[model samples]
Target: MTAVRVAVIGCGSIAKHRHLIEYDLQPGVEITAVCDIVEERAKAAAEKYGATAYTDYETLLKEEEVDAVSVCLPNYLHAPVSIAALEAGCHVLCEKPMATSREEAQQMIDAANKNEKKLMIAHNQRFVPSHQKARELIEQGEIGKIYSFRTAFGHGGPEGWSVDGKDSWFFQKEKAFIGAMGDLGVHKADLMRYLLGEEFTEVAGFVESSAKEGSDVDDNAVCILKSASGVVGTLAASWAYSAKEDNSTVIYGEKATLRLEDDPNFSLVAQYVSGEVVKYELGGIQTNDAGGQTTSKVIHHFITSITENTTPPIDGEDGKKSLEVILNALESAETKRICG
Candidate 1:
């Protein structure tokens, strides 16, 4: 097997927990470089993953041997870094909420197309066994016709999770752009789109900073979506929940309803119209410590697409669709009106 040389562009929590660690586990992939503005963080990741370290991403991109790069930077830098890597002849696996705006996301897609490289987004929830099962059932007509759904992802706060606590770029409007919506809501929106196999046509939302004092970004948000197929649903995300919930999605169909919760266990429960409830315990979707399970799967798909000259399951266009949904949600909140 020819190993693909991979470089990580950020040493943040997601990079450390998902990108680097998962790539380390893959037999046909090698973590060749780690980059971060903080030299110490990059060096630590390099030492941990047995890879080279660079404080600037440009240095890593210049390495001729690197076949791929993971853009794990803050929300704002996702598009710029991914475009640079793709233009440099490297496949890119970008983290979720692909970019702060639709235009930026489209630019990344355009660059990928121009370079003829695989570009994938890390919407890991789509790879979870339970979520896949839900998608399968929906596709197979087990749910009849999807009418509506609800999903959420919430956590205590960014204080402990982020390297810089309240001082983290996540709390800053300029660096992070939107708050919980970008941080967590985007996952639910993507999950809903994946399960229903539809694009959100409109969105209405409300955002607030209820928990933290002096926070510029939102700590909680709720958005309602209307899909192209006329399915109506609600998506909620927050960093203010007392207990952490990773990712949860519920789909209501004409014949039944399906529920998926990431923590506690990966279980799929369906309540039928006949009053017979079915439960499926899916232990196969388990992730190693650091939430790298889906990350690893996404990386594998990206590499396979490049190696085989095929399209990835969640390609650049897919990333743009998810980003559009979230961005529209933000616009809805700001104007107190539905947006597309």
Candidate 2:
């Protein structure tokens, strides 16, 4: 089979670190093109990867013969760019917080359906080894009757991660739409649903902008989530974790408790009612810190789904459902009432 030609729509930190690097590692994949509004960034990536570069995505889509494209643009551009790529006869792998609203996300999905193409969301937490192990243990009844849980994704803000630093679109309300809730909260929301195999029924939370000095978007948020199976838990997203990044989850159950990514050495640990403890040294998760670029397995998965003509693990509807949780959380925060 011929290698699947791919293009990256943004040359930001995510593109440089995850999408581009991972795509290069796949066996039957070729980097055909890259696009970015900033010409220099696109050119740099193109030169390094030996692909063409364009400042405008529409031009790149029209000119390149790519089988798939990674929509690594900002939160606001995900839907539109993905729809365009799908319409241009290319499968799309969009980044998280897939769109600004349900309508936009649905539009992207519709375009993919109409074009007979795949649409995958970049919710990499679901692919983490420890997270997958936790799900398997739960499925095997290792943690019986899950009652409650707490999951968090926090860092010291995106200034250190984004290419533009403080001036990146991440801190702007208009471009980012929502801040910590969209950036970090959505990942945990999707991960919790994947691990527990349940949908969120209701949410109530506090969203705040008290972290960064001159940012209009929220930097810290706390949400109370209730799952369909009567499992209640807390989900937190914050750019205020100044000391260290915390991407951890603890699930409480009737027979045992599961802790994931909560330790420096052990990536996962399960403690049982019988005074037995099992620890898993499954390596570390992907992080923004230097030398922390563990493979997310998202880009490779997207390529495989396209080559195999199968539905991606996190499809467009899955992205929409995860997005809905954050949307309802925002509503709950604003109205001071629970939202479903």
Candidate 3:
């Protein structure tokens, strides 16, 4: 079988760290080209991977003979680039929150459907080994019926992560669409829905600009989510976890409470109401400002889906639904009412 030739759009920190490294980890993927507005970044990536480089994404789409592309651009450009790639007959793996809005997300999905190509959102949190184990335990009824849960994803803002530092597109409302809620909160919202196997029927949120001055985007958000199955919880995303990154969750169930990534030695802990406890030896979440590489299973699965001609686990529609939580949370915070 011919190897899947791939290109990367937007050679930023995510592209430089996660996408490029993960793509290299895959067996039958060839990095054919890279695109970025910054010639230096693109050239560096190209030199490292021995791939062609292009500044204009449209030109890359038209010129590169690739099987797929990773859309690692700003949140706003995700839909446009992905739709263009699908139209160009290449599968797309987009970084999340899939698009700026639900409508744009739908258009991306529609494009994938029209082209018969896979569109997988890079919501990497769900792929964490601890998270996977939690899902497995939930399905086996190890945690019993989940009654409530709380999940949060936060860090010291994208300045610590983005190559552009404080001036990155992540801090601008116009370019980022939404801030921490979209950047970090949407990730937990997606993970919440995934673990519980439920849709967030309604939500009320408090979105605020608590940090990161000189920008209009929000830096903190607290969202109250209710699943269709009567599960209630809080989902918080913030860029003001200046002390440390706080990506943690605890699911309360009839049998016990599962504390995930809540401990150093034990990544997961099951504390029964009866005073009995079980500590899982799984490694805790990546404990750093710069995320670790072991966490991103997105590329491997995306390439496998394309090579096997199967639907990706987190397809375009899944991305849209996860995005719905973020959008509705923004609405809920703005209107000060529960929104769907």
What tens-digit string does per-residue lDDT give for candidate 2 at 1-340?
9999999999999999999999988999999999999999999999999999999999999988999999999999999999999999999999999999999999999999999999999999999889999999999998889999999999999999999999989999888999999999999999999999999999998999998988998899999999998999999999999999999999999999999999889999999999999999998998989988559999878988988999999999999999999999999989999999
lDDT (tens digit, per residue) of candidate 1 on 1-340:
6889999998988887777767887778888888999999999998988899998888778864799999998888999999999989999999888988888988999999898888999887777878888889988998899888888888777776787777888888888888888888887888888888879899998888888778899889888999998999899899888664456778899999998863355378888999998888875443433543444477667778877889888888988888888888888888989998
Question: Residue-pair clashes per candidate, as listed?
Answer: 0, 0, 0
What is candidate 1's TM-score against the reference?
0.94
Cα lDDT tens digits, model 3, 6-104, are 999999988987899889888998999999999999999999999999999999988889999999998889999999999999999999989998789
Q: In candidate 1, residue 300 scores what lDDT?
A: 66
**Which model is ahead, 1 or 2, in terms of TM-score?**
2
Cα lDDT, model 3, residue 108: 94
Q: What is the C-alpha lDDT of each candidate?
A: 0.84, 0.94, 0.89
Ranking by TM-score: 2, 3, 1
Q: List candidate 3 segments past 4 Å from native.
A: 286-295
Tell me the TM-score of model 2. Answer: 0.99
Off by over 4 Å in 2: none
For each candidate, give its TM-score against the true structure: 0.94, 0.99, 0.98
Is candidate 1 or 2 superior in lDDT?
2
Regions of candidate 1 where Cα sits further than 4 Å from its true position: 262-266, 284-296
